[model samples]
Target: MKRVLITVFAAFIALTAAAQSPIVQAHLEPSHGILVGQPIRMVVTVYVPNYFTGSPDFPEFEIENAIVVLPQDRPANSNTQIDGVRYAGITETYVIYPQQAGDFHLPREQVTVPFALAPPKSTIAQVPLPALAFHADVPAAARDLDYFLPTTALTMQQKWSSPMKNLRVGDTIERTVTVTATKMQSMLIPPLSLDAPSGIRVYPEEPVIHDQKTDRGDFVYGRRTQTAKYVIQKEGDYTLPSIELKWWNLSSHRLVTATLPAVHFIAAANTNYVTELPPESEPAPIAPIRHRSLWKQYRSRILITSLCCIAVALLLAMIWYWLPRARRRLQAWQERRRHSEATYFHNLQRACTQNNAAESYVWLLKWIAVADPGVSLQQALKRADNPLLTSDTNDLGESLFAQRIQDYSWNGKRFAALLRQQRKDHRMHLSKHQYLNDLNPK
Candidate 1:
């Protein structure tokens, strides 16, 4: 009886195995054709004759990578199907692009599936299909032309980092500007450029940028960073017109213009440019001096004595009010002086940090300028002889600026600060007669 039961179980297993091995095939739905540069869809169907319905899960099917060539820019979608009893009907489709004109082949993959549970470990399966060759011929005219020659892009950006809205005489301000681009060039170059202001200074870097192309489009990456400084020795509110840049777009094949918003700032002057209002017109003329009587002089003396007290009170009041104001002004001036000294050293440090032969040599010019305001920058750089500063630089400066220079590289910041610092520090020079006059307070 046990043998008979085992035989029955074996027959059931055989039946299940036969049911799972379904016959499969693939075929394209459309018999017509597809163009080379256009989009086309093809349906692949597999017929499963002995589809299993025993509430059993089957092995999943998948295509190999790279083996299945997806044409340039072609999108593909796929699925599977089964038939008979509990059959799964799935249809696989492919979006194909034939990049080049050629004959191609589509071959079937070998698929393996396990079936038995406790007896025979598993069964090997072969996906039955043959390779089919297809032709992809492009127009002879397109073979010689390049597809990526022209491109176009549009980008916009804004920034606001400028200092004082109201710039006064003896005050210097800097503006931080940012420029965005569509199809831009080297970001290493200075992005922000100004029409050199007579009393203002502008500093910037050359542009350096790079980008790579992706599926959607070419991605652009670059940055232009610079400092545009302004020194206004005059006073007034001014409006700078909108900044605009024009460039040719390759994709659109046209010229494009980008305009920035307008800029507004105020300017003010120091004591030298200011004055108080005067009466409409002066009295016609003054009469000649007159002599005072003795009685009048006695009355004048009494009045003078009272007037002297009032005058003293007024003078004291004026001093009381002005002393605080004077202190604050003096403090502010000292702070500015300290900042100036700090900056002189900072700039020299920056120049030294740059190891590039050309940049270091060029910054050496700025270094000399910071050290000696009256010395021509070109002349000083031309005479640079530290080997770090090129020997040719000296000749370049002389040939360029027509000035004699002492060849040297500034290795210290104190000298740079003292370039102009000495001018103010020694202004208190006292002459023999002036010191005597100060003591007398005449």
Candidate 2:
């Protein structure tokens, strides 16, 4: 009887501890029929016994031969009942793209969760995430292609910077090609080859690639833009090669090809075209004797002139190097001073001295903001408790918003004087308060 009781007591304690511990669950969506360069969703859910005091710390991890994307949206909240006990849960999603066909495994990781054990009592728990495995393979139909693109939709567009119909030997034209794909990454799109005929010169620019995402952080589409400039080197009719991109359509499960048509144009010989000429022939050997005679006669003057030229060149080089740096420093300093509190106060005083009601009101608001942040202008005025300042400010407002502007006139000078007096009184009151606080210990 004693042995049986001891065994039952140990079993009960084990069950109680298991009930209080946190739980972690992970799984993949569409676990079968995954293709290369396709995105898969990985959902991870964490649950605590009572309620969560703070969000769970989900770790970011990487898998070999694949691209991992962390959750872009906030965690989804959920509640579930397990073994007759309620559990509060949060779910976070991840996106993974396999670059090649292989088996991928997600290693175990640790997640920290903060939750309330009871009302007003909180604790943190470290939960272990279980390992997950998945497989990706290339479709037999897409095996022959050099690059694999698995998407629901794909499109290609072309634009020219100028008309391609003109016939000129020295004229140049720019051609831009844009490729857009749905449910794929921009980096997976292959580059377009812009090869021109032998007679034409081709200069290819760097390609621009980006992806667009929805508000919840899901990828909407990917776009790739390429540009090339063609210059007409010789006069003749030239034909540019066409471009074709092959991709696998995920919806139809078939291969699709997007093409841009070829371009043909005629180039006529330009009459105004000028060819580079050979450099002038060097002076004959016999001419150096005459040059040497002249050089000997003015050698001292030539030396002096050359030294002066060198000094001037040095001075210009120094100024060229230092001028830009000095200008940037000066501009930065001026910007800082322009936004200072003292500058705003000075502007207010100037506006009030000129008796410009509109300008004075604008500067008054600015100065008040710098003086006391989070306190309204009316509140500050009430705290000052000055009847004259209040009356002048009211008159200033009337001048700004009155139906008839000529009906009311404001005295900015009196307002400025009263404002200064109120500031002095406030400062004196603060000094007295500080003195009293220092005199008595708390």
Name the best candidate (by lDDT).
Answer: 2
lDDT of 2 at 201: 83
* Runs in model 1 lying further than 4 Å from the true structure: 1-151, 156-158, 162-164, 183-192, 205-221, 237-241, 250-252, 271-442
Which candidate wins on TM-score? 2
Question: Which residue pairs collide in model 2, if any?
Answer: none
Residue-by-residue lDDT tens digits, candidate 1, 1-442: 9999999999998987666664443454333342232223344433332221111112223332211222221111112333334322223444443434455555554433222222223233455443544554434433443321111453434454556555566565655545444333332122444543354434543433444323423235333444455556556666655766554344444455656677677777676533234447866888998998877769878888899999999999999999999999999998677546355446444544442322233334334444555344333433332343334344432332232335544333333333234333433444656788988995
lDDT of 2 by residue, 1-442 (tens): 9999999999998888779778999989878899998888989999887655445779888988888888853566666778877787778898888999989988788898866666335577888888889999989998988889999999999999888887698788999999999988898999989999897889999999999977655668999999999988789989898999999999999999999999999999998865445568998777444445777899999999999999999999999999999999999999778856678778878879889765676567557766765444566677878887888887975665443447665788888788778767877999999999999869
Candidate 1: RMSD over Cα atoms? 38.7
lDDT of 1 at 151: 19
The whole-model C-alpha lDDT of candidate 1 against the native structure comes to 0.44
What's model 2's lDDT at 366? 57
Count of clashing residue pairs in every prediction? 21, 0
